[model samples]
Target: MNNITKEITPLTQNDCFTIFSRVKKEFNFPLHFHEEYELNLILNAKGAKRIVGDNVEEIEDMELVLVGPNLSHVWLTHNCKSEEIREVTIQWHKDFLDEKMLKRNQLSFIRRMFDRSTKGILFPRETAQLVYKRLLVIDQMQGFDSVLELMSILHQLSTAKSMRVLSDATFNNDQVLNYHSRRIDKAFEYMNANFHKPVALKDLAKLVNMTEVSFSRFIKRRTGTTFIDSLNEIRLGHATRMLIETTHSIAEVSFNCGFNNISNFNRFFKKKKNCTPKEFRENFSGTRVFI
Candidate 1:
C-alpha cells in the first residue's frame, strides 16, 4: 500500500469521490463532515451528543442515524471508556441502490425515508436492534445477496416506530459546505494540503484571517475537537483506509500515516482501534500468521 499522508485536507477525496464510512473503531474522533450520504449504527456504546446534521442529543447504546449527502454529522465516541470493545458501522454510496426502484410501488416507503434523511434520521433502540441484526448479514454478504440484504435493512429502518429526522439545517447548510459558516474554507483547504508537516498555530491562524487564540476557540467550537485532535484523526483515517483497501506491512502503513517511528504508531493504533495494526489486517482478511 502507498504511504498515507497525515495532512488533513478541507475535503478528503478518493479518486474524485469523497471517502465516507467507518468499519469499527475503538474510539471515534471529533466532528468532521464530508460529501457523502452517511448511515451509522453503533451498538452497545455510550457517548455524549452527536450532532447529526443540525440535531443534537446525548448518544446511547444501539444508536442509529442516517444523514444525507453533504450533511454534517458527529459521533462522540470519546465519552465511552471501557476495556471491552463493542461497535459497528455501515455506510455506502448514496446511489448504492437503484434510484428508479426507490419509488417502484414496493419501495416508496424506503424512498420517503431517504428524503427524510436529507435532514437526518434516527431510529429508536428497539427498531435499531431489529435492523442491526439484518445489517450484520448485509455486511458479510456479497453480490446480489448484499443488495437484497441492504434493501431489507432499509425497509426495516423506514418502518421504525420512533423514527425521527434530526437536522433542521437547510440542504445547503454552509456549515456542511466547507465550514463556510465560519469563513474558514481557505484555511481548511490549506490544512489538508500540508498536514503531513509541522503547522504552527500562528500560520494556520493567519491563513484563516484570525489570531491564534480566536482561531483556536473558533475551530474547537465549530468541530468539537482541538487542532491536535483533528490532525490525528486525519492520520488515523488514512491509515484505516489503506488497511481496508490495500496490502501493506504494519510498519509501512504506520510511516505512510506520518508516524515517525514504529513504537508510537503501535500505541496510537491500539488506542484508537483497541487492536494493533497486524490484528486489524488479520481481522479484515481472515488470515493469521502461524509464526
Candidate 2:
C-alpha cells in the first residue's frame, strides 16, 4: 500500500499537544504516518481493519491504540453497521519528553511504555472502556486541566496490565537499529522496497560491507529474526491487508504478496494469523465505501 505522510500541528497556540474528537458515518483517511506520537480511541467501529506497520488485524467494537513516530497506520471501515463512529485522537511530539525528565524514577513506567510504542501498542478493551469517559471529557477541558488529565490518562495506560504490541519484531528492530547505524536504515529501505521479489543474504551483506556469515548473525542479533522471517512478515502484512480490503481470491492474494505457491502462503498465513485467508475474510460483517 502507498502511505502518505501527515503533518500534525498543535491544536492551540503554545500548546505542545493536540486533541480532537469527531463523530462520523465513515472513516475516509488514507493509509498514513506522522512524526508525532498518536493516541487514538475508536467507538462503534467493530470489524474495522487496523494496519500498524507490519501488523494487520480487525478491531472489535471499541479500540484504543498508541502509535509511535512515523509508524504507518490506518483504520478502515470493514464491517461496521453503526450510523455513528466516535473517535478521539491525541497527538504530541516525541521531544515533548525531555531526556532528563524521562529518566526520573517516577516516569520510568511511562518511559518504558514509550519505548514499547516504537511498535504500535494496543490496550485491552477493558482499559479502553475505563478511560473512555476521561477521553470524552478531554475535549471540553482547557489550559492546565486538559494537560493534567491527558497525563493522568497516559499514566493509567502505562500501568495497565493487558496490552499487546502490534507490528512485527522486525519493524521495531529496524526503528531501533536506525538510531545506531545508517546502514541498517538503508538495508530496511531496500527490503521494504523489494520484498515482493527474492532477497539474497549475499547482496544485503555486500550492501553493508559484511560477509554473508557475518550478515546472517548481524541480522539475527539486530532484528531478533532471520532474514527470511523478516521478509515473510513484510509479505504477510501486505497479504492480510489485501484480504480484508479487497475482493481478491486466496490464490491471487498469495501470489501478489510474493508467495510462489498457494500451499506455502496458506501455511505461513495460518501460522501468523491463526486463520486461513478465506476465514479471515469471512470474519468481516460487511464492507463500506469511504466517504
Best by lDDT: 2
lDDT for each residue of candidate 2 in 193-258, tens digit (9 for 90 to 100): 776687888888999999999888877777666888767776776676677668889998888878
The C-alpha local distance difference test score for the whole of candidate 1 amounts to 0.62
lDDT of each: 0.62, 0.75
lDDT digits (tens) for residues 1-291 of candidate 1: 011111222224322122232345455444544445556766656664577655777677668787776566666656765444344444555556558778688888888888888888888888877776665545455555665666677787887787887877644344332343544556555565665566667888887788999989888777656776666666776777677667888887877767667898788777666668788667663211100
After superposition, which runs of candidate 1 have C-alpha atoms over 4 Å from their true positions? 1-26, 171-243, 249-291
Model 1: lowest-lDDT 10 consecutive positions: 1-10
Q: Pull out the clashing pairs in model 2.
A: none
RMSD of each: 10.5, 12.2
Please state the error at residue 262 of candidate 1 in Å.
19
Each model's backbone clash number: 4, 0
